[model samples]
Target: MRKMLDLLSLKLLRRIEIRYRLINSFLLVSMLPLVIAGIVAYRESSSASQEKVRIFAAELVKQVAQNMLQQIEKIESSSEELAMSERMQNALAGYYSKNPAERAAGHGEIIRLLLENYGSFEYVNQKYVLDRRHRIMDPQVFAQLGDGVARFAEDAPDMKGRPYWDVYSTAAGQNSVVMLRDILFKSNNRVAGTLFVGLRPLHFSRIFESVNLGYGSRMLVIDARDGHVIVSANAADGNAPESGLVVAVARNVAEGRDNFVSYRDGDNKQQLAAFAPVPHTNWMVVNITPLNALNTEVRSIRNKIIAIGVLCFILALVLSFIIARSISLPLKQLVGVMKATRTGNYLIRMDYEGRDEIAVLSQRFNEMASKVHQHNERLEELVAERTRELEQANHQLEALSATDSLTGIANRRRFDEALGGELRRAVRSQKPLALMMLDVDYFKNYNDRYGHLAGDDCLRAIARVLRTSSRRATDLAARYGGEEFAVIVAESDSANAMQLAENIRNAVAALQIAHEDSPFGCVTCSIGVTAVQVDEDMSTDTLLRLADVALYQAKALGRNRVALSDPAGATG
Candidate 1:
């Protein structure tokens, strides 16, 4: 410990001695003060720049959050007024007075009355209705919402008494916020049924988008129910939860706390973002600014500071050159010794033998050259060893990320990346990109019957069948999660994909994996097939969603058959 301390002290002292001996006497004294001033200027400039950025981001976030809050409040107020309209209360009073069809007709008239009275509630992008039975009566209502909203009536039994907040989606696939108000229609002052009026996403989006913000900044209304991002601008549109950032911001908004956050933009290298929550809705407004734009003023200041430092350094150098010859006579000799050592002549010695600091500096330089040569050799060995270890670790991480542990098939992450690349390429080449989403029929029952370990074996067998059936290099079979798997067959159409899926299904059947609890004779699989035509507007997210919707359809229509959605069909 003492030796190490002594070595550190000597090294610092050696640098100081070299500075004084080789530099001009006047400039050497001035260098310390100049360096101190430069440091102070750099620190102050950095602090001011950082503070400015923080303030700008915070102010921007606060403004956006406030705007969003106002917009949602407006929508909520509009919903309230529509719910309290006389037509709605009158319709609800007689809702149970007649059959479902009569109730629907009455509800439609009430909705029309509300729309005629309040123009704000009528929008092309929203669906408004009062749903009593499994049927919904609306002019613009989506056919898909018929089933989903029908189930909700059962979910909320007390919905007939008072106004309750119910959210739903439009048939056009946009999110809709519905306020269900109890309507008491009375020819003789008695309760009737219920009235449901909806506030559209576009209404909120228009209001949210009206707020002025910086470039590339966006306000998005997201549905926390299913992670469907309803209204967004200046971002890739999709429902996938890539990061928990939106969910976290949505939570903050729900809690009525306007907070600020930062994250990296995935699309660009230099982008940084700050996010804030919009109150009273599942909405988050993010302020995105490129680092280059944010730090432009700071960078200019840094460049100017560097330029000044260089000019001062040049002036110091000239002054040192003028007065250094006589005082640096020993340094000139020591420099010659260093030059000799540079040419592999370390045997050469400095001439100074005086009992001064320069003499000690010269002695230390001679010792330093020897130590540096030894360290160079050892450092090279250490660097090579570390490089090899890093490469190995990187390879391991890549493998673990791409390969599923249970079935040894490609994982969802790998499938997403690889299939996205292939889809882009196929689209460019004007070839079809085919996808088949497969799920083990009654795999949950299989797990219940045979145990989880046997379920693992069943999955392994199924994965092997899929891998074997997709023999082409362009075909990729990936484990989509749990008992679900997906195959991306590039340059193939719907017919070819269906054939490939059928082959895989048959191969799994041939494995004869017996399951007495299986509804389908033995362990079987259901398949959903979809194909994306080569087109300029085709997107990876949309294609995946279509395939997913088709998969759901396949499961819904009997469990052991194949189902396909129309290529241009809207995804749920």
Candidate 2:
């Protein structure tokens, strides 16, 4: 860099006005300290404002959590009232009566009392009561609630008269908060039946209704038992695209404390979050307020600093431009041509008529651009040829993916794709479609006696026969699975299909591959053929199932034979 500056003659450096140079120098020397002072002032102010906002948010969320907890306590108190009621206790005790008529009357009385005192029917789903025996009181209502209720009930005995809280997402797509309380008998103070109440997600909506948090502020009531959010306000919709991020943030925040933290939310906005525990319940309230909403004073200070800096920059920039204008014009033109050349526009040339240093630079640049143009033309042709070769390799890879590695026939994936297309074609053209399933008879025993390698060779020899039998363009032969193959023949009837299967059977028997485990003393396959007149009602699986049934019959009757099944699936 020093060498380059030394090359610039003193006459060239002296061409600019000295006043502009001095002014630019002064701005450079003074601006750094000014910026540092402004930053210090802004940081002090912003820190104070942020602390204020954090404390305010913490208190606000704490109050909200306490209020929500009070509403829940009301439910517990109401349940207590029911537990202390004489009539309700008698009805619950009589629920386990041995007499059928008394049990019926007790069940009716419990229902009537719950409807009048507790608003059990107001639940999105009916509330439940489980007797001391762990049997649900309302047997008919069991179908309404699902296995989740059974699981909740199973835990009731272990709770031992304490309250349990849980949340579940229902089949109806609503979330419910289930609270279980063990009701006690007043006479002996022993435990009676347990009362279960389900609060719908909308019940939490009441807690959120009065909260008028500003935009970008979110609040969630998370069940501490599990990290599931019972209700959320100013929160991301569970079905929204950003729900995963929202859930992650809620779970990522620490629980069981009254604390504040700075975090980034789903929208990529910085947020100040506060957590407050709901008293006496396994839940907490989370408040997330975007930093932008609380950073008004800080933003103003930042803007003032930026404005002062920008003005200083503009003043220095204008003076520097005036001093260098004459030298920069020609250089900027050369830079433009260089940029165009980098983009492969090598034909672009700088137009410089003066005999200055720039003229010499332009001359050399033109020469280099011409040489690059020639080289690039050759590179284009080479790239095209290589691209064609790469395309051919990709095609080969695709074919290999669909072909069976051992038998070199279509794999099951290819067979399924072909069958669907061929079935459509056969139906459209009014042609018969025949499907054949072939399994090597006693193949597992053969593998046990000979070896897996011998079994593989035996199957490969049989694949050759089926592949040869499928001679038409509409025919597809595939290795369905190990020691099993299938063929789809278009434009063929049952008679033709049976003939093909018989030929395939004889060909496998002709292989004369030694199989000492076989009754026939050689490797052979049982073929099952099913041909159907293509109809809209039939599917690829239906045809395959029929052929498989016939193949099973062939294996059952004897080791090496062809069996045919009618469309009705009766084997012959």
All candidates: TM-score: 0.42, 0.47
Q: 1-572 in candidate 2: lDDT tens per residue?
A: 44544333223544444455556556664567556777787778777867776777688778889888787888778877877788878887687687544676778788777677656346444476777765667644535464556666775446655676667555677667777888888888888787877787667756777775553567777755444677776445452323333444456554533377666655777777666778767677777667776666666776687567667677666545544554576688899889877677999988875455666788999998999899999999999999999999999978987888889999987999999999899889998889999999888788888877887787788888888988998888999977889999888999998998888888888889888878899988899988888678778878888898899889889859988876774322
Clashes of 1: 4
Off by over 4 Å in 2: 1-322, 335-344, 353-368, 371-375, 569-572
* Model 1 spans with C-alpha error above 4 angstroms: 1-328, 331-361, 570-572
Task: After the best TM-score superposition of candidate 2, give how far the Cα of residue 533 lies from its true spot, in angstroms.
Answer: 1.6
lDDT of 1 by residue, 272-370 (tens): 445654554444555545555555655566566555655666666554444343335567777777877777555566656545577888788878877
Computed on alpha carbons, the lDDT of every model, listed in order, comes to 0.66, 0.74
Cα error, candidate 2, residue 405 (Å): 2.0
